[model samples]
Target: MKYKTKSRHIFILMSLLLITSLVAACGGPATPAPQAEPAKMEEPAQTEESTQTEEPARVEESAQTEEATTEETTETASATDSTPDSGSVELPEVDPLAVTGDIISAGSSTVFPLSERMAERFQDEGYGGNITIDSIGSGAGFERFCVAGESDISNASRPIKDSEVESCQSIGREPVEFRVGTDALAIAVSQENDFVESVTLEELAMIFSTAETWADVNPDWPAEPIQRFIPGTDSGTFDYFVEEVFDKDEEPILSAGNLQLSEDDNVLVRGIQGSPYAIGFFGYAYYNENQDTLTVLSIEGVAPTGESAEDGSYPLARPLFIYSTAGIIAEKPQVGAFINFYLTYVNEEVIDVGYFPASEDTLSVAEASLLAALK
Candidate 1:
């Protein structure tokens, strides 16, 4: 009987020790228990004073626990050290229905279709207010936004010129630029014309400036008069073309014979499609929209695909932009909301509208610009 009683006491003591270890392991550093660990380690069921024989062991364990806690805290602090150097800016997701009031944006006949599509989507997704996007040329658009100060937003196929910036400043506005997408200028001709599939840079320049007939540009072709259709002087498309082909000199192109110019790309498109001898150039989206009736010529043997445009392989690829002042955005909260929505969802709509999406890095900069303006 004595042996059985001793065996039962040993088993109960071991079980108590196991439970005490588990309870100690589960205790968190934040929980107040300075003396609890010492007490538990020294005695399973007795007070600290009654189990003083193991006091030294408890002290050592308490010191080790403190050291462990210090190490954990150091690790946590290192993990949370966040100082931004460079990356994407987080833009707020827009709920169009929650946005109110009218937004007026004008400029860039090239960007008009993309902006129009976005506005349509804003309305389709429950935006209740008005969004007016005018299809005037980029220069004319900036004139309205800066010199006239009648517009809340100005869209451009090119960056705002220094003079335009001064105009904005004179009106108590500092323009902010947001890069939205890239466009590869499409040189197109009527599909009925099969004489040329591509043209070199040298030939392209003459085709618009000096060449009066198809045979003037290339031999072994019919000597048909070269019907030249081009964007008007105020158009950003015209400016970009002149910069690329004429080294920014407009005299040659302006003096060319049989030249036709218009701010409307549709008019240019219709003119180019009217005759096999006709040729013109405009935004890739315009060519894409009228592809069935037009054949887009390759420049220097390189065509304008999304990849080519994004990679800078296409010679005529150019960045598209929209300009607005912080004052305008702040005064018209609706304009700010619309721009936020534009930056947030442009990639989803850009490709379908016939332009390539801006690179992620470029788009992030635009988002950062908007955030800084809002602040």
Candidate 2:
């Protein structure tokens, strides 16, 4: 009985020990490692300290940006100072004979005779350097001046087109125009033809395009087939004729039968001289050269002559031009000097070249333009 009571006491003691261990596991305080770290997050932030540390770097970046901006502004102003505007340019009167350097020019077959004469006079006056002039038409000349950037000067029978100006601007060249002379375009027929002396604009158009026979143009005339000769499409004269006479529609004239087109005005003169039925138009200089072989026609009772061209009496009269930029003049002093000489002497030689001298006001304006460009 003593041993059994001792055994019951030992079992009850074991049961109490196990119950105490379970209560401790279920309800005792945790170590709280995660919660302790969360409170530490509320302490002094290192980000604020890092931001303060980067303050100097931000200031430095701003300073660098401002410096770059200032540099760019300075460079822009310096560039502007280097290139002067044409309106503000001023050129001093200088001697052309003392100038040197080769001159390269292209454009305008009509202007060729005038330029050639000027070049000869320039050489006679003592310019030893070669002056090369090309008669490659105005459009081709602009291409050489603007697109190719090859020629120092471009001669044009007509003013530069908007497209040509755009081309020059694209290549960083701004063309300046100088009116050099006036041209009287002459319509000529073979010397053998004496029946027709004058024609109206309508009759001229009909003769060149729609009229197949002389009777087609006029009932009183004979039924001879009409022959037409004209400048090539590349010629500025062609553009002018199409614009003025055909209303810029070239199809009627270009599509006509018995039509001959040539870039050389001399060829056109020859073509007209070949047959009495043939007729053609070209610069007055060409007509003047072949006057014996060809007959100059009276258009609407107006004849082409220097006085008629200058006085604006001739219907086919047009202005002639030569172009050079201010930059070109400054860079090539010889070109500038040559232009000065040409302008001073053009009026004297223009008649010899079969063109008219520009009016006094026109010459003055040209001189001012040149002076302004060179200033």
Candidate 3:
């Protein structure tokens, strides 16, 4: 019984040893089971992610290119619609008038400024050709207009004398009258002369006529001999002054023999500016142009300005004129057009140039008369 029990114990021990060896051979506590790898599926996912990122970059680059194209197109459109920097615009090429010929105008020195301004503006606005203007005195201009058929237009500082109009009719040229503006025959002296301020119309007549010395008009004035300057007899300024002041018939003062006569207002300005005792009269534009050296004199306690002239406060104010030949208007449509432009576009410039624009009604009448004469 003892041997059999001992053999059984040995067998159990052997079995226990065999199981322990088998566990050790398979794996110890430090080693774990190997896991299966999903390499094929993971590889395809990584490749797809890379493709998605690169596609966004391509899309961003394409978007940038499209933006650049849009900007370029906008710039091109802006350049195409830009205005030219040159002052000349692209105006239609059309003749502005029916008649195209040379224009010759001569008239009052007073009207010369306005007429010349019209001619200049007309040429700039693309009139046919050169419009020549002569600043001959009014009487001389009338003589030229009346003798035969010389001047196309005559500017007169005064209304046409009946004799002058008759002379035009004798030559078969009917004169169509147009008033351009108003003027104040400005009397001026040296700016340095401060004592004499104002003068009466009667005093002006005395001073301009044969009154040889300043003391003759007013003993209170400078006892120095009055150095007088007068516009020539041919001047419309002379005619207006004589008619208004001397009752159209008074003989000139014989004492005025020492007076200086000049056809040019500029000459008169220099004469007055140089002499302390000198007094002279001319168009207001001359005084305005030389205000530094010449002092305009107020007449009868009234100053001469556009407002004053309009209100009739300025005693020396007078209407100025332009006389067009009826024949010229009928024969030349450009002449009529030029006249219309002068009355329309240049009225304000006329006043700005130191002459007074006529009333609107007067201008309308003048325009109507011009159109009628053309018809």
Candidate 4:
């Protein structure tokens, strides 16, 4: 009756493994536990996410409690040691109904919304086990996974670092990746603002970093000062922004005037809503959700859209990821099943979550990688 049933199938699978071992000891061919056919999970209706950083679309919560959910309660996760295999392969199919056991993941606050959406769908499709998604910054998430060795999956907006890979190897866990979707880092202003509609990378760099007033960045603009709202230092969104716009230099933006930083996107949204001078950025899903109250500024003459993001027309578009190891998936089949369900259903959920689907080819590549790892 408890949430920590530890999964009924896991116990049965363990019995099969023991039988296989005994058969091997008797010099007979061992029988492996059978994998069920991939389950057909009904896709959830897409929900609109807020477009502004001042607010976050709420994730539906269930009243069911997790008192006995005695799974991995650690705050951080272990980074698994793994490498990329770029062959075109088939996506893994999973029977979500057969999957069980708790799933613990934490990472990029930017990727948090999409992951949360997927996790909810997994639960709705008859998953009784616990699933916890933490919105800690990606760097912190990596530390949890790579240094602490606690999570089953590490959600990230960017790829794992080389040093992170080495860290995972040190702990005997090989990190495997699954590309889930695409995000357009929407640079947003309140809908009340009319003077600003779009900006170039140079203007953005100036606005977020060095410029004290709107006039400093653009001669035609008002002399009003710019208000900056952004994700905190540990955020992958912050890292991506600095890398792309500041060319990896943090000083200019970090020391910028009238800046407020937070790990939550909603904080940025609210900060921007307070004044026409305010501006902030986060994933497009937030923008889409809050479309009524916010305006997403085009970058480099191209607005952030699913078409633009997938086709690479959007300058701020980037791929999203979740990292896990084959070893972990094998040991905990529930993780494998959850990932399978995620990949299979993400296209439907991604739009609802306020992001774009990766191209069929890209998704297939991710699926292929997962299928290979589960072996």
User: What are the Cα lDDT values of the candidates?
Assistant: 0.82, 0.78, 0.72, 0.78
**lDDT (tens digit, per residue) of candidate 1 on 270-289:** 99999999999999999989
Candidate number with greatest lDDT: 1
TM-score per candidate, in order?
Answer: 0.77, 0.75, 0.72, 0.76
Top candidate, metric TM-score: 1
Mark the regions of model 3 whose C-alpha exceeds 4 Å error after superposition: 1-99, 253-255
Scanning candidate 3 in windows of ten residues, the lowest lDDT window is: 45-54
lDDT of 3 by residue, 233-320 (tens): 7889988887888877536732466678877777788899988788888888788788889888999999898899877889889988
Worst 10 residues of 1 by lDDT: 45-54
* lDDT score, candidate 3: 0.72
Q: Candidate 2's residue-wise lDDT over 1-375, tens digit each?
A: 999999999999999998998778764655556766864552231111222222434433433444433334334434554533443322344444555556778788889889989988888877765677877688888999999888888998999999999999999899988999998888899999878888888898898888899889988877899889998887788888888789999999998889999776777887888998898888888988887888998788998877788888778899999999997776666676778778878999998888888987777678777766655
Candidate 4 structure quality by residue, lDDT tens digits, 131-222: 77777788888888888887778999988999999998999888998999999999999999899998999999989988899999999988
lDDT for 3 (candidate 2): 100
- Model 2 residue 59 distance off true place after TM-score fit, in angstroms: 53
